[model samples]
Structure formats: C-alpha cells, structure tokens
Target chain A: MKKLINDVDAILGESLAGFARAHGDLVSLSQAPLFVRRRAVTPAGQVALISGGGSGHEPLHAGFVGRGMLHAACPGQVFTSPTPDQMLAAAEAVDSGAGVLFIVKNYEGDVMNFEMAAEMAPCATARVLTNDDVAVENSSYTTGRRGVAGTVVVEKMLGAAAETGMDLATLQALGERVNGATRSMGCALTSCTVPAAGGPTFEIGEAEMEMGVGIHGEPGRRRVALASASAIVEEMMGAILADLGAAKGEDVLLLVNGFGATPLMELYLVYDEAARRVEAAGLTVARSLVGNWCTSLDMAGCSLTVTRLDAETTGLWDAPVHTPALRWGC
Target chain B: MSNTLVLRLIEGMAGTIESHADQLTRLDQAIGDGDHGINMARGFKELAAQKAAIAALPLGEALKKAGMTLVMKVGGASGPLYGTLFIDMGKATPEAAPTLADLSVMLDAGIRGVKARGKAEVGMKTMLDVLCPVADTLRSLVDQNETDGLDERIIAAAGHALHRTTDMVAKRGRASFLGERSKGHLDPGACSSALLIGAVVGVLAPSSAR
Candidate 1:
C-alpha cells in the first residue's frame, strides 16, 4: 500500500502506459491487459509465438516481446491468469495468418484459462505447450513437474526458433522438446506480498528458509534453518539435477534466477556456488545465466533451472537475438 | 428453508471467515506459504462492504458477484477455489439465493466446479474435502422434524469429516505434493470450510431461541 499510484484499480493501465512511454520503439500496450509486438506479424509462413500469465513476474512474458520473441503477451493480474477475452484479443492482434503457438506455464489456473481462450479464439492452428518443471515433489505419477524458472529459457529458445522461420508445427514440437528437457527447483527465505494482499504472502523465520517452494508462496516440500549460499545452491542443484537425470558427462544450460528483491551481487554469489556444483558433479556446464530472469514478486529467494543440451537446442539457445529482457546473438 | 434464513447463513459464513482470517493464514504458513487468511479476509470484506446489496440481491447474482470479486482480487489456490464455489452457487441460484434444496444442489455444483478447476477430487487436502461432505450431510438433514439440533449435526459432521483428513493422503493443494508429511496436518482448506460452515450453523442456532 506504500507504493505510488493514482488509483489502485487503474494501476495496471497506468503502469502499462509508463512502459509504452519508455519502450515505444519496441512495443506498446493494447486495449486489453496485453502487450503485442510492435512489428506486424505475418503468420502466413512464419510461426507466431504467444505466452502470458499473471503480471507480477515483470520483464517476463511481456518484456520478452520483440522481433525474435513472443508476438503477443497477455498479462493478467499479479499471479492471476488472464481471462479468455484477454487471450482472444492477443491471439487476434498477433495472428497474421500462418499459425500461432501458445507457451503456457503449467499452473492450473493458467492452463484452464488459456484453454478456455484458445477454444474461443479463431486462428490458423495453435499448439499449447505447458511448462511444469518444478522438480519439487512428483505429482500423481510422472506428471509432477511444476513450471518454474525454465519458462524464461523455453521462451528464449522457442522465440529464436520462430525467428528462424520454423513453421508453427515445428516450433510447437521444439517447444515441447524444451519443455520436456528442462527442470527447476526453488527455495525461499521470505514470502512476497501480492500487492493487493498488502502484506507478505507468507512469513518465514529469520533462521529458516523453505526448500522446494513454489512461486505462489505455496509450501515447498521441505524447510530448514537458513544455510550457506553454497549449501542452498547445492541443495537446489541437487534436487533439480537429480530429477533431470542428466549424466555426469552431459553438457547442460544453467540459469540461476532471482525470485525478486534479491540484488545482483547476491545472485552472482549464488551463481558462483551453482556453477561449482555443476562442475563438481562431473557434468559440463556449457552455458550459464544468472539474473532475475523469472521472479515471484518481491519475494526474497531464488530458483535454478537446467536445460539438457543437444546440438539442435544449443543452436536455438544461441539464436536468441533481441528482447528488452534477453538480448544476445543478433 | 426461508430465503431470510439463507441470506443470514451467507452473511454469517462471510463474517466467520472475516473473523478467522489470521488463524487461517497462520495455518497456511506451516505447510505452505501463508495468505489464506488475508485472501479470504479480503474476499469476505468485499462481501461485507456490499452487505445490503448482497443480501437483497438474487442468490445467484450475489454469489456470482462474490466469485467474480475473488477471481479479480484474490490470488493463488483459495481465490480460484472459493470463486468457483460462489460461481457454482450463483449458477445454481436460478430463481433466488439458494433455499435448503438449492443450497444442497448449489454445493454439489460447487464441488464439481472445484474438481474441474483444481483437477482435485475429494481426497485432496483442499476445502472440497470438507465442503463436499457437509453438502451431503445437509441434504439428508433437510427432512425430519428436528430442526432443533441441526446446528449440532452440521458442526459434528464437519468436525468428524475434518478429523478424517488426518488419515487420507493429500492428492492436491500445496501439501499434496508433500505426500506423507501431509498426513498429520489437518487440511487447511478443510479447516477453513468447517469454520465458515460452523459460523452459518451458529447464526442459525440462536434463531431457534428467537
């Protein structure tokens, strides 16, 4: 409640206006709580990518909107899924004709809401790829992975794939592959406030941190008094890598993501530990990204994701060109 | 059976949740990150603020308003689940806010909505585990002359079903992933449902005195 705003209800619209003001060259806000590619999308031969979720994970689903990334991004409220109307608008605004693909996180609300919207939206052909790489505790059987930090990487690679002129079907298949090959694990030292909730989403003792925590402040599988950055990274890496089953000699892409409110220095320190653990396990850490690539509001914590690399995937990983959030090989 | 009584039940339920938000949040903080209390509290506060309109409005509209409010305002599992619950009740309120029979059918629809939304069923350590059973119990109580001890029956049933939560393994909710560790803890969802229903029953209790 201590934040600056003209009206609490119009905050989303006002903030979006501010973003459009700053990033006018790259993107602009649409009528809906959506951000579309400033460039016209030609869907005839090109595969258009779209992804959306709640708004709090900033510089996310939206910031990645650009030439090489998502053609449209629909943002719901903080940690809430967009309604069908929003998604329908995004699909239409971005669809140039060839086809559109939706990269959705595996949370139930996101999946259900997206499914509803897709059912209503008319497009060439759309594929929905759900990301659930939590690596927390197994769900019923093998369906247990919860989508976490891996979404940022999957979007990057798939964005690059689309940039390379991969057809919708091809991009869809590649997205599915990336979704399968990734896993993420998170730990939290404190809970984040959901802005509207007006307070910390949850609380943790100063001496303790929860392990296996999900983004929504849902309980993690385990908790213990806070430990060293090295130990925390080791445990997170251990959980993620164990679930991944990547062999010691295998090469992998690693991302150490800050939940939010964590500073760059702290992230680099954690990354230092994570990189060491990856090498110590005899696996080749081919490439590593350390930053607030994905977050859970201003929650003080971090998560780690690993993407098993193959020649094809590594190429896409390298192919990412430009986005407000991630920019590299152009 | 009266619409007057039914409206009172909802108001009482909403009040109960408003009162117990802190306890609920504290419980959630244990197995999951907290927020149940704050979310539900905010949800009910919205309901209370529009108390006159909500009580006077057709049951479905009121419930739908409640559900939509939660959907927009609350986040995480509780919002969706409670929102779904109210949505279902609203959808069931074809004629007016639910009467006794309508309440029964409304709750069953709510169960279905939650099951569909959460992909979670009765065994999940969610509110449905309690709400579903209580709905069933209430249906059976509609007949029979008692009406006097009905509150006790509702409370007893909710309490009894809640205790069973200890034995069943959680299949959904955050704790469901914990597998066995979830066994000992009373499902927070179930406990909250009991509190809400207990409030409804309590408000109706003094009615017999009146």
Candidate 2:
C-alpha cells in the first residue's frame, strides 16, 4: 500500500506522463493513455509492430517502442487488458502502408480485444500470439500457455526484422518462429499489489514459494517450501529446458527477467546460474538480456526465457536498436 | 419491454453497479485480480453518461450504443463480455416495443453472445450461470402463457442461479486460475449480472403488475 504515487486513480496517467517527459527524445504518449509510439513514426517501408497488455509490466510494450523495436504499445490498467479501441487507435497511427503486425500475448481478454481491433481496423492486419510461458497450460485467463518474458524476445526479433524492411507477412512468420522456439517459467517469493485493489493479489506464506508462476499472480503449478536462489533457478531452468528440447551445441537467446519488484542483484544471480546451466547442457548462449523487461508490478520473482536461436534470429537479436530500455548499436 | 422501460432499467442497473462496486471488488479479490468491481463501475458510469443521449432513441439503437460505450470505456474482460450481451440483444430486438416473447428472444441472443465471446457455458461459474437460466425461464413462461409476475420469476431464477456459483468451480477468466481454490466464493461476474437482471425486474414488475 505504501509506494510512490500521488493517487491510485492517477497512477497510470501520471506515470505515463512522467515517462513521456523523461524519454520524450525517444517516444511520445498518445492523446489518450492507451498507447505510446516512437516520437517519429517508423520509416515508410518498415512494417509496424504493436504489442500491448495490462499496465504494471513496465518497460515492456512501452519502453520497447523505438527504432528497432515496437512501433507502438497499448497499455491498459494494472493487469487489466486494454480495450479494442485503444489497439485500433494505435494501429491506425502506426500502420505505414506496409500493414501492421499485432504481437499479442495469449491472454483471454488480450486476445479477444486485439482480435476485435484487427477485425475493425481498415488496414491489412495480422497477429502473432506469444504464449511461451511453460507454466500450467490452460491456466486462468487464457486457453493455453500464458505469454511471459518471451514477449520481449519476440518483440526484439520482430522489431529488427521489420527494420530490415521485411513485409508484414515475413515479419509475422518470423514472429511465430521466435515464439515457437521460446519457453519461460517463473517462481515468486512474494505476491504483487494492484494499486486499485490496494493489496496483494494473492498471499504466500513466509516459508513458501510459488512455482511456475504467471506474471499476473495467476496460480502456478504448485506451492512448495522456500529454497535457495540457486535451487529455485535450477528447477525453473529444468522446466524450461525440458519443454524447450534445445539440441546440443545450439545457439540460444536467454532472458533472465525480473517480475517487477525483484532487483538486479538477484537477477544477476539468476543469470549467472542460468548461463552456467545452458552451457552445461551443451548449448551456447548466443545473446542474453537480463533485467525487468516484463513485470507484474512489485512482485518478488524472476522468469527464465530461453529461445533456441537460428542464424537469422541470432543476427537479428544483435541488430542495432535504440529504445529507452535496450539501446546499443544505434 | 418498451423503450422507456429499457432506459429506466439501464439507469437502475447503472445505479446498482455503482452502489455495489466495493462488494464486487471484494469478491474478485478472493479469487481473481480484484478489479471486476472497478471495471464494472467505470463501464456503467460511462453508460450512465449516455442516458440523456440514448433516452429518446429506439430500443435497438439505444442498447447498441450502450454496448459500444461499455466496450470503448471499460477496457477489461467484462467490457467485451457485457458489451456483447447488449449489442447482441439490440440486434435481436425488434424496432417496436418488445413483448415478453420478444424479450425472450433478445435474452437468448444476448446469452449466446456471452457464450461466443467468453467461450463459457452454464455451470462454469460465470455470468451465464445466472443469465442463461433467466433466459430459459422467460421462454418457458411465454410458452405456458404464465405471464403473471413474469419479471418476479426472472429475478428469482437469476438470484438462485447466482447463488449456485458459490458451490461451482470457476472454469473461465481470472477466477479459473484458482482451480479448486475458486470454490466457495461467489463469482463476481455472476453477481453483477444478477444485480443487472434484478434491476430490470424491479422496473418492469411493480407489485401492481404482479
């Protein structure tokens, strides 16, 4: 209940405004709180990449908006899906005659709203659904695996592919390739509080942890007695790797993502162990991203996303990118 | 239902959702992410804002506009689901004032819309648990020529169905995440739908009508 904010009602708007002010050089907020896009729209021939979900997963759909990433991001309230209108508006603003690609996470509301938007939008629109979380399939709020940190990977790969002047169909196909190759699993030390709700979404005992946790505090596979950080990472990696089936000597993209409240100190600890395990499994870690790329608002946990990489995907991951969160070879 | 009756029912439903906002949030907190009440209140507030504009319109157009308003403003699972209800009902409704049989057809269309949008059926601990039964009761009453106290019967059936959600397992939405843990808590969507049906019955079935 005690965090930095002026009021509960203004949290999303004020925070977005502050983000716009701080990163005005990189991106601009729309007249409404629904979306944020690059300060300058994408180049004329590049396909537009749009992704969105409920707010609270910061630096996600928004921070990724820039030269080689997302063209636009539609954010909803904390953990609530954005309306179709917002997605439509974002689509209209960013579609550059190359058609638009919606990189939707596989939540029921997110899917439904995005689908509605796609149907209503006048331009040619296609969707690439990311459902890389290896947690319980068909868990609450979705028909299949939930989209977790794999979204960050999908966005980056597709964003780079778009910047390469790929057509909407090609970008959409590349997006599906990345999503299909990725798998993520998370474990939570504590639950998160949605600002409007004024309390934690769920309760966990002091000596217990949630396994295979979804970002929105959805029930994981099971709860067990708390264990050491290394032990937890091993278990999480085991689940992800078992599902991934990466071949020996394969190059892969790895993401050690924080679920909002988890700090870098622990994320590094996770990355250290994750890198070692990937290497131990005879797979080469081609590229790595470590930070809170996707989150669930003040929840204490981290998720591990592993994408078995092909030569094209690996090269795209290294593509020059200029965004607030991920800026490098630009 | 007459256009005036439809307008009055919408107003009453808005008022009821506003008043019970906190209760809905509390119910959601137990199993879901705890924003059902907030989203519903925001959506109904928008619907209420359209009262003057929709009051004079035909029933189908007015209800359709109401659905669009909720879809644009609510921005959550409930927005599209409830919006589908009104929109489908509007499409199914005749241009003229609807008789009880016509209302039954409208409700049938609305419930089907919910099923299509949410992919949920009755006994899945969703709004359909209450809405489907009400639709059935309306059709049965019409078939039997038992129109006396029809609104009362609809409300009572809806209430009973709403209560039944407490014993059922959630198979949709955020509550479904809880699995067995979702049991014993009343589904918030069902609660809101029941309140909406009750408000309509309150307007359409005064004691004199009974």
Best by the DockQ measure = 2
Candidate 2 per-residue C-alpha lDDT over A244-312 given as tens digits, one digit per residue, 9 for 90 to 100 = 988899999889999988889999989999999999999999889899989889999999999999889
State fnat for each of the candidate structures. Answer: 0.12, 0.50
What is candidate 2's lDDT per residue for B152-185, written digit by digit as tens?
7887898789999999988888777677889999
Could you give the CAPRI-style class of model 1?
incorrect
Could you tell me the TM-score of candidate 1?
Answer: 0.75
Estimate, for each residue in B54-130, the C-alpha lDDT of model 1 and write its tens digit: 66666677778767666545555676677778888788776743456666778888878877877777776778778
Name the candidate that leads on lDDT: 2
Candidate 2: where is the Cα deviation over 4 Å?
A: A139-142, B1-3, B208-210
* DockQ, all candidates in order: 0.16, 0.52
Question: How accurate locally is residue A162 in candidate 2, as Cα lDDT from 0 to 100?
Answer: 92
Best by TM-score: 2
Indicate the DockQ of the complex predicted as candidate 1.
Answer: 0.16
RMSD of 2: 2.0
